[model samples]
Target chain A: MGLNTRIEAAISNAVKVGQAKFPDNSGAVPPRLASALAYATAPGGARIRPTILTSVAMACGDDKPMLADAAASALELIHCASLVHDDLPCFDDADTRRGKPTVHLAYSEPLAVLTGDSLIVLAFEILARQSSHAPDRVAQMIVTLAQRTGMPGGICAGQGWESEAQIDLSAYHQAKTGALFIAATQMGAIAAGQEAEPWFELGARIGEAFQVADDLRDALYDADTLGKPAGQDDLHGRPNAVTLLGVQGAIQRLKDILGGAISSIPSCPGEAQLAEMVRMYAERLTPVVSPQSVPGE
Target chain B: MGLNTRIEAAISNAVKVGQAKFPDNSGAVPPRLASALAYATAPGGARIRPTILTSVAMACGDDKPMLADAAASALELIHCASLVHDDLPCFDDADTRRGKPTVHLAYSEPLAVLTGDSLIVLAFEILARQSSHAPDRVAQMIVTLAQRTGMPGGICAGQGWESEAQIDLSAYHQAKTGALFIAATQMGAIAAGQEAEPWFELGARIGEAFQVADDLRDALYDADTLGKPAGQDDLHGRPNAVTLLGVQGAIQRLKDILGGAISSIPSCPGEAQLAEMVRMYAERLTPVVSPQSVPGE
Candidate 1:
């Protein structure tokens, strides 16, 4: 199967596991929680992080299909959970995500909170269930995921930064957006029986590039086009690359990071394939003028 | 060391691991997040869950100190996380917990949410990091923790039940309170290389008894004596044993369950000791009148 198809299947399977685990013979949970969890994960976009992870695992000469799929699903679940929490009234107060009403809007705030908490736990459960081949590797995968998702410097810490009077943009963005991307790359290598350290820099670079691209989108696009609110950083008075460096400067930075990412791919049989994937992602990250932005004819 | 001292040390160590994992020089998270996490976990109440877990492990002949300590700490962290979320405006909307302002009240709503999220993830991370003796055991511990904390009937599901139109009292109490207690017993057995299934009944019975005790306290005690807002169940219009069974009936039920709990101890080397512990807990559960309650008399 193609990478996208495989990624899709892995996510579906993970969702099934999450849903099935609840509402067993015991008094089942109110169906809303289960449905909300499925809703947050379904109809996913791009599957970019998992794609990067699966590709890295394949490149690393580790063909443990179940393990790779589990790792990819686990990381995606964490990403989805972060989004669910990030949209709450306490955080971004976003009404829409992926062009639909946010989970907190569709469900009550309490359920939304529970849904996010459930998903995070489900991610670790999926990995533990799938990592029978290499228990040690599974242990490492769990730690890597927990570190990226929790604090003192995980995604939670990233969100915590927004509440502070002073901000460090690099640290903020890294934990906020880059930690999961790093987890994706490192976990892929770990799943493939490879040392995780060599791939760390590559993941960091790619994550930085993605954040820069996101900044460009947030500044230049409208909510309708982005499928979520744009100009959120500005709306919240939080820092962003575009605010620090104008649109042109941000675009230039994106290019430099993506270029660095391609060069930093750790040597492996799939090094060329990984570079090709990075190049493809870089192309997508490059912004083009929408019809709305064109100068008056 | 005595069980109380050992339990205290175990919690401290786990908190250290959780805090250190964050702020890894990538511009540390805003210090507030770290302090909030520590603050939520410190000056713990009772340490009942971890103490139960440690005692069970000791009874089961699992002398691996680190593994046992890690399991105990992981369960307590999960319990603590639940309290943090339960106190949020979206849930209980309480102002005080464990004799201090609730986390959201102390920090902010967003931080409370993140603090809960961070602690849940930290629980699993502690187990994975500390359970190097037996990888499979670590995997089991992770699954046990997640199952009790998340869905198809974890603590999250328990919270989810509150949002539903009709609630099953048994299932609600089981998931909301019993799940972690079950986890404590099962994980302690797992930590000691024993099968987790045998201890399920014992944990569930103990959990039911504890919940009953909680209902008694909630109905009978005032806020100052309870150290939290009393009559929360009534205020929220949520289900509770006291509401369903009445004060006298609930007290009778509490006694019956504690009696059953003593009888339910699975046959093991620790069987007698476990019974004695349960008997002692039963005495504690049997409450006495406080000075504040003398007004009516």
Candidate 2:
């Protein structure tokens, strides 16, 4: 099968694993909370982050299903947790996500909060218990995950930076978006018993490129095509590449960053495929001549 | 200092460490979210868990300020995160905590959710970066903390059980309260390069005793003395020991558990002080002349 098809299958399998690992939703206390967790984690998206993780793992000469699954699953859990919290009434107050009502909107605010918390803790648990890598490697992954999810340069810091300081657009994007992406790549490499510094840098650049593309999409694409709310940055008064560098400038910078990311990957078994996927992702970000004919379409 | 005075000082120091660690309360794009996090975490209640953690650490023969402070701070952060989620409208819907309005009540629900999420991540960050122990020990601590905070046997499962299963009082108390207590003792011993199994059992028993005492306090004490609203368990229809075992039976159980806990500690260099502290705590649990005679009182 092609790389795209393989990635899709991997994501589907990861989602199944994530869902199966959750508390049974049919129980008595209230199915809503578990349902919300299931709902938020189901209906899988592009699974770009997990794909990057697994791809990097493959590039490092480790195709072991267990290692790939653990790394991908851990990244997905973090992504899902971030989404749940991001949609809370305090953050985006999002009513819809991935064409369905967000967790909080579908359930109650408390359930959403708990579901998010559960997911965060579950991410670490999965990594600690399931990884086939050495204990030290797993420990490194856990520490990296925690650091990226917490303060200074993690998601929490990324989220908090918006309120506390006058941050540069690049720095903001790096923290908010690049941190997790960096984690995904590094974790993948670590899972395969490879040093992660080079891959970490590559992932960070790709993440920045992706964020730029996302900023452009938010400004130029419709909600139907994006699968969620669009034009929210302006609505929330958040600064983005679109605001800092303008449309054309942001697109140019995105292409440059993507190229840099692809070039940064060391020549390995799956390097060609990894580089091609990055190119395809970049191309997918461009405006289509036919509105419905996006590349991922 | 007396054991009580020392415990109180340890708690205070832990609170200071936690607060200092996350001093910045500003968000990157939305300042309100950062403010919400600060408000939620800053004015916390008595840092009882941290005290327990440091006490255990000290009892294990590692009394370094740095190690004790790191463990204490991390535990408090986890507790704070749990409280934030618990008080959300969908969970407990509590408006006040420790005499102040809860995070959701003070800020918007979305911000409260994000704040809680941030704190959870921060807890792991503190452990990963600040623990003054070997890397493997740090990893073990992280695993232990994550397991207790996550599902199945952790606080997550405890909360989930509240919604779905008719949990036995012992199981409920074990997961919800005892897990963290076990973690505190384990972390303490781990910090001292000591075995954790015996301390883990001791802490778990002490935690069970503490929970029973708390239930009694809720059933028999007044709100003014408790600080927060009383009879919350009854309001929520939670099956407490007081309800299932009866007040006198529960009180007797508390004493027995405390006695077992004190006896469980293996004789060590600091065994006497640890035993003394346990005795003082057990004595405090006896039917007091006034509710204000409780530890926090």
Candidate 3:
């Protein structure tokens, strides 16, 4: 199956398992919450993180596809859960994501909070269920997911940076954006019975490139074109690559990062194919905007 | 060491591990979010959940003390995280808990949200780290923690019931109150290399009894005595045992449930000691106030 299909299937299966009726079939996941899990995830955006994970796994010779698949689902779920929480009133309060109402907008704030919380819990649970296939791998993946989802270096830490009075741009970007991408690559290796350390650079480069690209899009494109609110960093007085590095500089940095990402791929059976995939992503990622079209330029 | 001491140490260690500086140690966790995690868990209330977990683990011959400690920390962290979210402006909006300001009240709402998210992630990470000690057991504990923390039958589902137009009281109480207690017993058993099925009854009964007792306390105790708002369930128009069954009826039900709890202790090496612990808990849990003390009685 295709990568998106695989990710979609795995994610759907996880929600099914989580929302399944009880032993006595008392009820099904309190209905709305069960549905909300699906609601928050469907029509997935780009499926980029899991795609990177699977690509790295294949590059490393995915000996256990099941473990790799679980890792893919796990990584994606953490990403999705972070988005849900990031859009909450306490945070971004974003009403639209990928052109659809945010989870909190579609569901109430309470359910949205629970939805995010449930998804985070379910992400770990999904990996744990695969322990029968490879207990050690599952354990490591759980750790990776948790590390990339939480503290000093995870997405939450990324979000936490916005609240800080003095933000460390590198640490903030690393935790916020690079952490999961790093998880994607490292977990992919770990799941495929490969070492995790070598994959770090590849993930970090790709993650940094994506963040820069995102800043570029937000800076250059209008809401209708980007499909979500643009110039949000400026609007919120938040830091961004475009703000730190002038537009041209940020674009140049994006190019440099993406170029480095390809070369950073550790030696693997499918290394060539992984590099090609990265190239394809780099093409798709960089916004196709003209200098004349740049807003306020 | 005493159970309380063990629980306290385990919880403290887990937070310390989560907040520890990274390798090469450039920057620590977003200081505010890290501190909020510690702030939210300290001066803990009864700590009934983790206490029950450790007690059960001991009862079943905790051959792996480290695993049991991790499980206790994981379960309590989930409980603490839930309380932080539960007190958010969107949910219960509780200003104070156990006489102190709630996490959100003390920290900003955004920090509170990230703090809760971080704690939840940390809970699973705690269990996953135990994988090196006992991979299979750690995996099971992760699954157990996720199941009790999330959808279908977890605390999240319990909270979901309140949002529904038609509530299922038994299911509500089971998910909201009993889920973690069930997790405590089952995880304790899993940690000790015992089957999880047999311990469910003891946990459910204890949890049910606690919910009912909580209702009684809310009804009988004043704000000064409770150290938090009194009559919150009634004030919120929430469903409670006392409301469902008259005060006397609920009190009787509490007694019956606690009695069943003691009897339900799974046969194990520490069975007698476990029973004594339950009996002691029963005494501490039951409100000592009389009918006259119950306002509007």
Candidate 4:
């Protein structure tokens, strides 16, 4: 199957596992919650993190496709869960996400919290279900996932940065956006039986590039174009590449980061292909950069 | 170590795991979040769930003591996480837990949300960290934790019920309170490499007894006695055994349930001792009960 198809199928299967009854025949949850789980995930967008995970696994020889699928789904679920919680009234209070109403906006705030929580638990369950097959790899996968999802260096830490008065730009960006990318790459390698260490720089670079691209988009596009609140960094007086580096400088920074990401690919059978994939992501990431704007691809 | 010591240490170890740096040298999370996580769990009241887990594991011969500790810690973390989230303004809106300011009140709503989210993640991470030692047991532990903490029949579902106009008392109690009890018994067994199915009834009966005991306490005791708010069920117009059965009937129900809990202990190496523990728990659960209130104890 194609990468996208596989990732989508795996995530769907994981969600079903959660929606299904526990093995001991416990009671079913409320319908609204089950549906909220679906609503929080459906109409999927770029599927960026899982795609990176799948790509990294394939690059690492893809010894265990099932493990890769489970890891990918688990990573995406964490990403999705973070978004659900971040959009709460206490945080971003975002009205929409992925161009639709945020989980809290669509469902009540309580369901939103529970939904985020259920998704987090469901992610671990997805990994555990695959454990017996590859105990060592699954164990590592679980640890890698947990590391990237929580503190002291996970996305939860990223959200916590928002509430603080003095923000460390690099730390904030790393936790907020880079942590999951680190998870995506590291988990992909671990899923395919590779050491997570070597892939760290590649994931970090890609994450930095993505964050820069996001900043540029938020700066350049209107809310109609961005599909959510735009100029949020300026509005909140938050740090961003566009503010510090200027438009041209930030775009150049994005290019430089992507270039670093491609070069940072560790040796593998599919190393060349992975580099090509990173290139393609760069193009997708910088779609607004015209031929003259970037000077060269 | 005593069961209480083991549980407290394991929980402290688990929280430390969340606070410490990831192995890959990522940025450290904010201190406030780390502090909030600690604040949410300390001065813990009862330590009831972990104690039950420790007892059950001991009853099952706890071949892997560390695994038992991890499971106990993981279960308690989820319970603590639920309390942190449930105290948010969107939910119970309480200001205190365990006789102190709630995590949200002390740490801000955003941190409380992140603290709960981090605690949930940390719980899985704790189980995952133990996977290398006993992959099979830890895998089952992870799944059991997930099953008892999330939907379709976990505490998240229990919370979800409040959002619904119609409440199913059995399902609500099972998900909200019984889920973790089920996890305690089942995980204790799973930690010792025993089958999870046999312990389900014991956990369920114990959970029901505890719920009834809780209802009786909430009805009979005042806010000072309960520590947090009292009569919350009545305040929120939520369902409870006291409302359905009256105080005497509820007390009687608690006695019947605890008696059933004692009888439901699955045959194990420490079956007699486990039964004694349950009997001891009954006294603790119904402290206000006079000798005449529960005859032939």
TM-score each candidate.
0.96, 0.81, 0.98, 0.96
List A-chain TM-scores for all predictions: 0.95, 0.87, 0.97, 0.95
Output the worst ten-in-a-row residue range by lDDT, candidate 3 chain A.
Answer: A20-29
| Candidate 2 structure quality by residue, lDDT tens digits, B1-297 | 643455445445433322343222232333555456567665556556766677777777774545555666677778877888788777778877787878877775655666777777766656655433465566567677776776545676567667654454555667778878887888778766677676778878878887888888888777777766788999998878878787778878999998899889877788888888779778877665354534333
- Give the per-residue lDDT digits (tens) of candidate 4, residues B173-290: 8888898999999999999999998999999999999988887777667677788898888898877887788667787888899889888888889999999988988888874756
Give the best candidate by lDDT.
3
C-alpha local distance difference test of each model:
0.86, 0.70, 0.88, 0.87
Q: Which CAPRI quality tier does the interface of model 4 achieve?
A: medium
Q: Which of the CAPRI classes, incorrect, acceptable, medium or high, describes model 1?
A: medium
TM-score of model 4 vs. true structure: 0.96
Worst 10 residues of 1 chain B by lDDT: B288-297
Per-residue error for B83 in candidate 2, Å, reads 1.6
The Cα error of candidate 3 at residue A26, in Å, is 1.6
How far does residue B95 in candidate 3 sit from its true spot (Å)?
Answer: 0.9
In candidate 1, position A21 carries an lDDT of: 43
Q: Model 3: per-residue lDDT, tens digit, A1-297?
A: 887788789878887877887773266558888888888888788889999999899888899999988889888888889889988877777878888889898989999999999999989999999999988888989988888889867898888878889888778888889999999999999999988999989998999999999998888888877657778888888778887887888888988999999989888899999999999999998888787976567
What is the C-alpha lDDT profile of model 1 across B83-153, one tens digit per residue? 99999998889999989999999999999999999999999999999646888888998998888999878
| Model 4 segments more than 4 A misplaced | A23-27, A287-297, B287-297
Task: Categorize the docking of model 3.
Answer: medium
- Leading candidate by DockQ: 3
Q: After superposition, how far is residue B291 of candidate 2 from its true place, in Å?
A: 11
Ranking by lDDT: 3, 4, 1, 2
